[model samples]
Target: DRLKEFPCRIEYLSRLKSASQQREICEALKAGKIDIVIGTHALLRDSVRFKDLGLLIVDEEQKFGVSAKEKLKALSRQVDTLTLTATPIPRTLQFSLMGARDMSIIRTPPPNRYPISTMVSVFDEQLVAHAIREELARGGQVFFVHNEVNKLPQLHAMLLRNLPTVRCAVAHGQMRPSEIEEVMLDFMAGDYDVLLCTSIVESGLDIPNANTIIINNGHRFGLSDLHQLRGRVGRTNRKAYCYIFTPPLDVLTPEARRRVAAIEEFSDLGSGIQISMQDLDIRGAGNLLGAEQSGFIVDLGMETYQKILDDAIRELKYGEFSELYGDELSNEGEWVRAQDCQVETDLDVALPESFVRSATDRIAIYREIDLLQDESALNQFEKSLEDRFGHLPERVKSLLTIPPMRWKAASVGVEKLQLKGGRLSLHFMSPGDSPYYGSQTFAKVQGQLSRYAHACRVRQMEDHLRVDVDGVQTVGEAMTFLDYLSNG
Candidate 1:
């Protein structure tokens, strides 16, 4: 019978020790005994074959050997293959760019994923002990990351000396497969309070209970690596802390500063999207495509690079891309407005965040929009702006700076539109029949034009100020009561 949790029937392919089960499963897959299976490299073998395989999903594709990965690809030929890896390779980025692969980002670290508060300081035993105690007090586990596996014993001894009562263990790749699994299982089961280990803990393990991490010699790691490592903890709602300790003797590298700084910057939810995470996305894109595309990204920048990819995707999807490379596009304003005619005027307009993300993005977006010869496209793009951001929020409204030209007009005694008392009111006109004139006041004539008193005075005011009322008609004057005024 199919298991309730799984869509397909589940069966045990072999009965063997955990160490040897991977190879056994690979042989089983080769013989077509399992519909879908999960195992490590031990499951990778020449004999492995699938009988009408529908999908092959491999988690952590980076761990696979190049030849093995290539062979695996062939196995899923003409079938959908979903390879997952936390550290995305350049090839994956290319595939996403070229539309060869579908990518989904779990960028929002799970809900209540407390951003790990990281601190960079010289190694200190007291600080380490205090952090460990604090986390354990909150019923959380700790990961003491020390990359050097050879110094595992010495490190463990130091950790013991600092916190002798705390249960702890060490793990590395050199350990036997069973031993590594046992330690991981014990740690997962909450058998250990702390795990002093290598970078193997970077991905594929979710331990919400682990809320604190201490990375020894963290400056040695790259930004991406450090991000991945930091991601290991703070899976729960409780605030997590990651302390990166580096010796003062070591000259702090720029990359190290960037890594630590990113960890600090992203402590708030949804805040790190623009920085470290984007770099990961870019790196992933580069990995999937190839190193050759890296230069294109560096030259054009990430936003521009993404725009090019988006354009290519649209062209491939719709079969009609208006702007071809090397096409001479005119920037005449009249032509732009003409193109916009295809779009209904009533359609709501929206200003793209690309226009608002930063000054650079805004300038580039403006330039790109200007180059568009298609009127409907521009209108559609504008409509997108209105729909996405809605009526401008107060925060955005605050950024509005009245043009200097208008400021000059106000200074020269010219009345202009302004927001006064939350309503637009004339600078010189008022409800009460009072002369509300500025410093260089000339004339303030108010009364119905139909009234003889108003008619004679209006003429006098217009003549004195040299104001032209020529060929101008006021409908309200002869019907409903209206007021007139002239001032300097």
Candidate 2:
């Protein structure tokens, strides 16, 4: 019924195919006879040509290298490429953030799905038997990932001795592809209780009956790799478990400890994005513009790098991309305006612990506030807060005023704004004499300073121009004065 509804020819091509079969498939693809074709990296072979391929969907993209993807793009540069992964790589985030790609987030999970229950523990034979037996008792199978090929046999022997009632099979990349496929087929057919293999099982295997995976020395795997392996299970509505065994924290390196903890902590549905973000945070932002997607991001320091990047992106939007994306660039939200600009105020600006008790919630709220672009959005946010957390405290109300003040200060080319001891100061660009002086906003600011008389004063600092004003007692007062200074 499904095939009839679609009404297109479909074929599978892989290394398992004979020469003639592959040739036939390639010919069909080249002649536009095949409507849908699914296969391994075998599809990427140059022999497999396509006639005006309109769409290319690559799943588990983190497993593919950059050059391979580039070659795929070379086949059809105009092809609408969709790369799918549970854990997005750092490179993917970089491109999406740099305006090179569009990103759509699918936070909703499929119906009848269950989040995997994940854990990190020191390796012990007893724990292994318990996890395996638990799955078996529930009429499910298990995947035991022992990455070291040589050690796999010893572990398999030990498992057999400990859990003699369980039927187990060994599969690894060192074996012939045919043998591995047969073993996988048997495991899926309920011929084996556990498939003890290398991480090769991370891909091209979908058996909903396998609801648990045990990884030996999971600390050795990369963050994304661990995610993919855990994802091998939990395919059905049945609950799943991923036991990541690692060396004890006392013996493991700090980096390995973090990697282990991260996978264990993110077991909820849609945790792939969170794991990727944690990976980025643990590994810095990486070399954004280069193929080396991680490491050495600490060179310029994140704040400095962000400032330079913001300036560069703005310059690109106005200089190079202006001709092509003028409308879009001009329509970008409040983030672009306030981004490169830093706001420094002496006022006590914190989500008082009394308001939001949990430190984590307070931090998340602070981050959300920082992203809000303008006053209207912030006013709406204030209403939501009041609705959720009773009346807004005086400090909470004061905290809401910073966003608009920062946006206004940025528009006038003030890199920093400081309100200290009832005195407000707007610090202009470093090396004061820049194109900012030629902008209409700066002209309006200058007109306001002169018109306001004793309320405002301008001082020439060594690297920047500082505009000082009086009568700013609270954040609200500071925001009011800033609005008047920017426009009045």
Q: What is the TM-score of each candidate against the true structure?
A: 0.56, 0.86
Off by over 4 Å in 2: 1-5, 284-289, 298-304, 315-338, 348-404, 429-440, 459-465
Q: Weakest 10 consecutive residues, lDDT, candidate 1? A: 336-345
Residue-by-residue lDDT tens digits, candidate 1, 1-488 = 33548765333432224536656665666577776665555445565555567877787665565567777777777988777665454455455545677776556656555656778889898999999999999899999999998888998998899888999988887888678889998999999999999998987678888889999988787555676788788777888888988867347765456556666666655443344444544343443332232232444655555556764554443234334621322222111111111111111233446336667756654455534444466556556645754564443332221222223223322332333222222232221221123222222222222333422323223212211222222222211111233221
As for model 2, its CA RMSD to the true structure in angstroms is 3.9
Top model by lDDT, which number?
2
Candidate 2: lDDT over CA atoms? 0.81
Worst 10 residues of 2 by lDDT: 331-340
Quote model 1's TM-score.
0.56
Query: Which parts of model 1 have CA positions greater than 4 angstroms off?
Result: 1-23, 61-69, 85-87, 94-100, 107-113, 247-250, 268-488
Local accuracy by lDDT, each model = 0.56, 0.81
Q: What TM-score should be assigned to candidate 2?
A: 0.86
Tens digits of lDDT, candidate 2, 57-77? 988888777677778778668
Model 2, position 21, has a per-residue lDDT of 97
